[model samples]
Target chain A: MSREWVPFGALAATVILIQLVTMFTNTQYYLTQLIMAALYSIVVIGLCLLMGYAGQISLGHAGFFAIGGYTAAVGTTLNLLPHRDHVLVRMAERAGLTIQTTNSWGVDILYFSPWITLLAALLLSGVISLLIGIPVLRLRGHYLAMATLGFGAIIYYILLGSRFLGEADGIYDVPGFGLPGGFTFDGARNNRVLSYYFVWALVIGLMVLMHNLVNSRPGRALRAIHGNEPAAMAMGVDTARYKLSLFVLSAVCAALGGVFMAHYNGGMGPTEAGTLKAVRYVAIVAVGGMASLWGTLGASVVLNFLSLRGYFGSLDDAVFGVVLITVMLVAPDGILRRLGMYTLRRNRDTAPDAFPVSAEKQVQRGTA
Target chain B: MSSELIIQYILSGVTSGSVYAIVAIGFNIIYNTTGIINFAQGEFVMLGGMIAISLVPFMPLPMAVALAVVITAAVGALAQIAFIRWLKRPHVLQLIIITIGLSILLREAALHIWDEKVRSLPYFTGTVVTSVRIFGAYVSPQVFWVLGVCGAAVVLLSLFFGRTLIGQAMRACSADPLAATLCGINQKNMVTLSFVISAALGALAGCVVSPITQTHYECGTPLAIKGFTVAIVGGLGNSTGAVAAGLLLGIIEAFSISIMPMAYKDIIAISILLAVLSYRPTGLFVRREVGALKEF
Candidate 1:
C-alpha cells in the first residue's frame, strides 16, 4: 500500500548495518541505546495512526502519551490511591460506609493493576477525545485546527501545576512490573530494546488491523467523509459516526503508544507532551502524506533519524519548517516514495500522465 | 466567596472580556471581509504591548500606545499586502493553516527580536483608584477603562461605517463584493483597510489590557484562541455577537474557578466551547449571509 517500502527497507537495513558496526567496534552501551530507540517506535506507530489513517490533527498526543507513561510510573512507584490515605481511611472507619485507601500513605488507592490502569488510560483518552472531537470536528478547516491546538495547551498547563503528578519535575524511579515482583529487578531493567520489541510487535499488529480497515468498506467511508462530508452523507455514509469512530480509534492508538511509552521511559513529563512534539508529529504525517500508513511510518522513522543526527540540537526547527514547506510545494506526497513510484513506472514503460518524466521524454524525442 | 471577592472576579471577567471582545471584533472584521481567520491577530496585540514597552521609556503612556497602534496598523496592512496576498486564496481550512503558520513565524520572530522577558505598558487611565461597591464588593478602575475603550471603538466604528463614504464603501464590499466592484469600489484598498482596522483594534485592545495581564510572546496564542473561541460563539462575522460571547465566556471562566476546583477551571471553558459548537454550528445567535460576499 505504501510506495516507500523499498526505500524504507533499504534504509532500515542500512541502519541495522550501522548498528552492527557500532556493536562490533567494542561498543560499551549498545544494549542501552538500542532499548531506548526501540521503545519510541511504539510512539511513532501510534502517532502514524492518528496523523496518517484517521486524517485528524492533534497537537496534544504528547500530553496523552505523557499521561500513559506517568500513570504507569506513578502507579508503580509513588502510588496515587487516595483510598489508602490514613486520614481518609480513618474518616471512612468513623463513617458507616466503608471505602479504604489501598496504600497506608494515600498511595495504594491506584495500585489495582497496571493492565487496568493502562486500559483506563486508553479508554479515558478515547472518551475524552470523543467529547472534544465531536464539537471541534464540526468546524470545517482551520477553526478545528486552532481548537485542537488549544486542547493541547490546556492539557499541558493542567499537568504543569498538578502537585501529586510532580508538576514539571515529572515522576521518577517508576517501578517496572517484572516477574510478578518475584525477581528483584533493578530500576534500569527494562531498557529501550524491550520497549523496541514490544512496540514493533504492537506496530505490526496495528498495521495489519489498520490496513484491513482502510482497505475495507469502512475505509471507503472515511475517505468519503474526508473528500466531502455532505456528498458522503448524500451517499448514505454516517459521517458523525465515522468521524467519532476515527477520533476515538486514533486516540486509543495514541493512548496505547503512551502506555508503552510510559513503561518504556520509566516516566513522562511536560517536555514530552509540549507543542514542539505535537508540531513534529503533525509534520511527520504531512511529510508522510496523510492517510498513507507506510508514508507516515517512513516519515516518523526519518524524523527520528533526523533527531538523532543533532536535528533537535541545531537548525532542527528551520530544517523541519523547510521540509514541510518543500513537501507542500514540490511533493504533496512523501519525497523518496513518490520518486520510487515514478522510477518503477518508467522501467515498466506504463506511460503515466502524473510522472511528467515520461511525457518530457516524449516531448524531447518529438522536438529533437 | 466573599462579596468583595465576587465583585473582583466580575470586574476581572469584564476587563478580560473586553479584551476578548476587541480581539473577536478584529477577527470578525477580517473574517467578514476575507473569510480567513487571521491567526496573527494576537501578534498585533503583542506588537502593541511590546512597542509600548519600548516607547514608554521615551514617551508618555498614552502616546506610546498611540504610536504602537499606528505602527501595528501599518504592519497589518503590509502583512496583508506581502504574505497574505501572495498565497493562493485557499479553502477555509487551508487559509486557517496558513494563518497558523504565519502565527508561528510571528511568534518566533517576536521571541527572537525581543527577549522573553515580561514587559508592561503603563495604564492609560493613570494611577487614580476608583473603587465601586456592588453588595460591598470592590472593583478597580481598570475595568471601567476597558469597557470604555471597547464601547468607544464600537461607536467610532459605527459612525465611520454610517457616515464616511469610504467606510460605507467598505461595508458595501463586505455586503456584496461583486456589486461593490460593479459600483466602482477598489477592493484592494478596502481589503487593506480591513487589515488596518483589524490590527488597529487588536493593538488598541492590547494597549488597554496591558495594565492588567502585562505582555509576553506566549500570551499571543492564548489570546488568539480566546478570540477564535469567542468569534465562533458569536457566529462568524458578527461583531456584536462576538462581544457578547466574549463577556459570557469570561464570566463563566471566572465563576468556574470560584465554584469548582482550580484544576478544572480552565478546562470548563474549552469543554463548553466544544459542547456548544458540536451541538450548534449556527452559534448562539445565528444569521444567514450570502457566502459569496467579500469583505470590507
Candidate 2:
C-alpha cells in the first residue's frame, strides 16, 4: 500500500489484464494495437523525462526514432560500403579473418546483421542526440523546441529525398530480430504473440527503470532543474551534463522503439521523422501530465492505442493537437494529476494522512 | 558557374527569400508585441494562399487576394481573442501549444474543405511565362512581383511603426508591458492588432508567391520552418535582420543544391541554423541583447 510501489503494482496488473484479453479474444488485431502502443510508450516516456523532469523540450524526437528505423531498414537492405576495401573488410583482412556473409533472397547479402544493425541504430541516435543537444540544450523553452524542430525537418527531408533509404516510399521488408532458439519476431503467424510479449516486456522493463530513475538522486536533480535551474546549479548540480546525458538517453529510448517498430511493420516510412509525429509524442506526455511518470505511461497507452486504431481517421493529428492544447489549458499538470487532486480532496477529511503530499505540491507548482 | 546559372540562382533565391521575409516579419510582429512565438503564423500564409486561390473563381485576381488577406488577418485576430485572451495565468509553453493546436486545426480544416489537391493562382500581371533576359538568364515576371511586393511591405511596415500612433503604442508595449500599461495603452488591443497585421502580411506573401510555388494544405509547416529559420538566424523580433537572414538562407540553399543533392537543402539550412546558434545565438546582424536566449 506504500505510494512508491503503486505504479509497479498497476503495471503488473495492466500486463496481466492484457494477457487475459488476448487469451479471450485470441485475435492478433487487438494485440497489434497494444504492441504498437507499447512501442510508442517507450518514446513518450523518454520525452516525459526530458520535458517533464529535465526541463528540456525536443520538438524533433521523431528524428531520433527515424534514425533508429532507417538504421535497421538500410542496414538490412543496402551495402553501406559496397566495395571490397571497406573498413570492415580491411579490419577482417588485418585480423586474418573472413567476414561472415549471408545469402538471403530479398535482403542484401553485404548488409550488417540484424543485431548489429540494432546496436548501430541505438548508438547513432545517441551520438546524434549528443551532437544536437550540446548546443540546443543551451537554449531554454521554445527556442530549444525550435532547434529540435529544425533537426527533425532536416532528418525528414533527407529521408524523403534519399533513394537509398527508399525515398518517401521508405525501406520495406526489414529483417526481424533473431533469437537463439530460431524464434523470429516478424509479426507473422504465431510469431505475433511472441513479438507482443517481447515488446511489452521491454516496455515494462523500461517503466520500472524510469520509475526507479525518477525516485533516485539524479531524478531529483532533474526535477530541481525543471523546477528552477539556477537554484539547482547553485546547489552543485551539473545542469549541462545532466541535460545532455538525458537528451542522449531519451534519443536511445526512441531509437530502440523505432527498431522494434520497423520490424513490427516490416518497414518504416519517412513520415516517422515528421514533426507531427514528434508532436504526437509530446501530446501523449502532456495528456499524461508533465511530472508524473505513471500518468505519462497511462496516457501513452490510451493515446497510442487510439492512434493505432485510427480512431480519429485523417483528423488524427488535429485531434492530438487539440488534446495537447486542451491539456495545457485546463490542466497543465495533466488529467491524471487533476483526478488525483479531486480524489484527494474528496477523501481529505476521512483520511487526512493518506493524501499524497508530493503529488499535491507537484500539481500546485504545475498550475502556478 | 556560368553567368546565366548564377543569374538563375540569384533570381530564384531572391524570389523565395522575399516570401520568407514576409513570413519572418509576421513572426517578428507577434514576437515584438507579445513575448509569445506564435506557431500559427505560417498557417496564416497558408490560409491566404488557399483562400485567394479559392476566391479567384468568384472575383478578380487582385480583389480575391485582397479579400483573402483581410479574411486571414481577421482569423488571426479571432484566434487571439478566442483562445489566448481566455487563459488564466497561462505559461509560455501553454500559449505555444495552443498556437500549435490552432495550426493543426487550420491545416486539417483546409484539408477537409479544399481536399488534398494542390491549387495555383494566375500571375498578377499575365498568364504567359513572359521572361526578361538578364545576363542571358531567363527571369520570370513573377520574380519582379515578389520583389516589388516585398519592397512595398518593408516601406509600409516601417512607416506604420514610425509614423502611426497605434504602431508606436504597440512598440511601447513590447518595449515594456508594465510601463506601457501604466501609460494607458491597451496591451490586449495592441497584441490583437499585431496579430492582425502579421497575418495580413503573411497573407500578402502567400497571395503573391502562390502563382509560382502553388498552394496546398501541407505547405504551412515548411513555410513555418523556413520563416522560423530566418527569424532565428536574423535574431528573433528583428524585422530587418529577418529579411537579411531570409535572403542569405535562400542564396545558400540555391548554391547548396549545386554541390549536394536536392534533399540536402534542408540539412544545409539547419546546419547553418545550428552553427549560428552555437556560435552566436543572437544571430548575424542583431545585437546580443535581442537574442532568443532571453527565454530563460
lDDT per residue (tens digit) for residues A46-110 in model 1: 55554444445566666666666666666565433345557754554455323224443444443
Any runs in candidate 2 off by more than 4 Å, and if so which?
A1-3, A79-111, A341-368, B289-296
Q: After superposition, which runs of candidate 1 have C-alpha atoms over 4 Å from their true positions?
A: A1-15, A24-56, A78-114, A176-205, A271-273, A304-368, B1-6, B128-139, B162-165, B168-189, B261-264, B287-296
In model 1, state the lDDT of residue B206: 86
lDDT of 2 by residue, B1-296 (tens): 89899989988988998888889889888888877778888889899999999999999988999999999999999988887877655666666678888888888889998989998889887665778888899987888999999889988998999888998898888877779999999988998998999999999999999989899999998888788889878877778888899998888888878999877776876777777767787768866654433543
Scored by lDDT, model 2 comes in at 0.81
DockQ of 1: 0.15
Deviation (Å) of A280 in candidate 1: 3.1
Q: Backbone collision count in every prediction?
A: 13, 0
- Worst window of 10 by summed lDDT in candidate 2 chain B: B287-296
Q: What global local distance difference test value does model 1 have?
A: 0.65
DockQ of each: 0.15, 0.38
